[model samples]
Target: MINSNIGWEISKNEFYSENAFSKIFDAVVHRTIINVMAIYKKHIRQIRHFIVCSMGILLLASSCSILPFGEVLFSNSESVSTQPTGTIFYDDFSSTTSGWDRSETDLGGADYMDGSYHILIDEKNTDYFSTLYRNYSDIGLQVDARRIDGPYDNNFGLICRYQDEKNFYAGMISSDGYFGIFKIENGEYKILGHDTMVFSELISAGDTGNRIKLDCYQDFLFLYVNDSLLDVQQDKTFGSGDVGLIAGSFEVSGVHIMFDNFYLTDITQTMNQEKQQ
Candidate 1:
C-alpha cells in the first residue's frame, strides 16, 4: 500500500510538471515530454488515487521549481552542484530570474536562452553584471562561463559578498588564461590574490567553456575551475551580501558571455549551534 501510494504521488507530479514545462523550455521539450509521459503511464495503474493531487502539487512545484524548465536540463548543466543538503538557491536561468535583477545600462543585459543565461558585451558596454535581490552568506556558489564572441582577453566569473556598486569580491578568470581575486571597497579595487596566468588547460582557448566554483564558508573561501581546486582565501572585509554575475573587457569589447548552471548551496544546518551555547 505504501509503495502504491508513493508511485501514484510521483506520477501525479510527473504529469503536472510537464504540462506547462514545454512552454518556456521549448529547446528540450520533445524528449523530456515523452519521457515524463512514459513515467506517468507506467505508474498510472498503481497510483491512480494520487494522480489529481499529484498533478496539482507538481504544477505548483513546477512554477516554483529552482530550475523550472525540467530536472533533466538542470542536472545536465555544467555548474549544477551535488549538495547533500541545504540549498540557499539554485538556478539554470531556465525559467526566469527569480530574485536576480539588473538595469538596462548593465551592458548587454541578462536573458535566458537555450537552457542558459546570455550576456552580450560590446565596445559601448565593456562590463556587465546582475545580482540577486538578497544577500546570502556561507554558501557554495558556482557557474559555467563561455565567451560567445570577441578576443579571449576578457574576464568573467562570480561576484559574492557584494555590498553595492563599489564593493564586492570578484572571483574571475580571463579567456587568455589568468585568474584573479579582488575586493572592491569604497570605490577602490584591491587585489587580494591572483595568478598572472595559470590553468590554461582547464579553460578553453577561444569561445568555449570554463566551470568555475566558489565555496564561501565563514571567513574562508575556495575557488575551482574544471572541477579542480585553484585557490583559497580567508577574509572578513565582507560577511553576508548579495551574489552576482560579472564580466570585464581588456583588449577589446563585444565579448559575449553565456552563463549556465548557476547554483548556490548554503550552510543552513549549522546556522546556530555553538553560538546557542
Candidate 2:
C-alpha cells in the first residue's frame, strides 16, 4: 500500500539538498519503506478485503482537516532519577525555529503545527521522521505522544543512535497497546530479543497521550511508557548518532501523531532498582 513514487519530504527544503549524509539517509529510508511494503504484500493477503474497505474510509478522512492536538489523559509518575542530570537537548516545539523538518506532500507531512511536533503519514505501511540534526551517545530521551487521527493500529515512538538511517535503534509503541524495541542495521529491520511486538497494558491506547522514555547507554536499551518500564534489551550494533521521533502506518494510513515535551539527557544510571526486585 506504500506509494513508491512519493519521496521523503521533510519541512525544510535544505534537507533534500545534495548533501552526502542526506542522500544516504534518504536512500536508506526509501529502502526501509520498500521492505515494509514487501512484507505487507507477502503476509497480508488474507486481509486484502479488509484493506480495500479501510482504504475507502481513510481516503474520505484525509479530505478533512486533521487535528494534531488532543487532551492529555496520562501522566508519568516514574522517578526522574533514572535520567541523567545533564540536558543534551530539549524542545517543547512551541516555535517553528526549532530546526525540525516541516514539509508536506501528497503522501504525508512533518511540521511544527499547533504548538507541537506533528507527523502525519497518509500512506499505508509507511514511516516518517523529523530528527534533530545532532549526534549523541548513551542518552535518555523522553516525550509525550498521542494519536491525533488515523487508525488505532499504528506506530509512533523514539529513535536513538541513528547512524545514517541504516544503523539505529527504535523503541516504539502502537496506539493499540503493542510495544517493541527494534534495530535497523544495513537496511534490515529486526526486533531485538523478540519475534514481534509484545502487548503492553502500560501504553495509553487510542487518542490519549502516553509519556514515553528511552535510554540508550553502553550496550543496554530501555523502553518506558507512562512511568513504567516495559522492556530492557541489549545490543552493540550502534553507539551514537542523531535522534528523533518516528510515526508510521501498518495496514492503514493517516497515522497522525503529535509530540511534545521532548527532553534529551545523558544516560547516567541503569534500572538498578527494577533489576534488584
RMSD per prediction, one decimal? 20.2, 10.4
lDDT of 2 by residue, 97-135 (tens): 887765554457676765677888777777777667789
Compute each candidate's TM-score over C-alphas.
0.62, 0.71
In model 1, where do residues sit more than 4 Å from their true spots?
1-86, 195-200, 267-277
Ten-residue stretch with the least lDDT total in model 2: 46-55
Cα shift from native, residue 210, model 2 (Å):
0.3
lDDT of 2: 0.66
How far residue 44's Cα lies from its native spot in candidate 1, in Å, is 64
User: What tens digits encode model 1's per-residue C-alpha lDDT throughout 91-133?
Assistant: 8776754545422322234445666776555443145566775
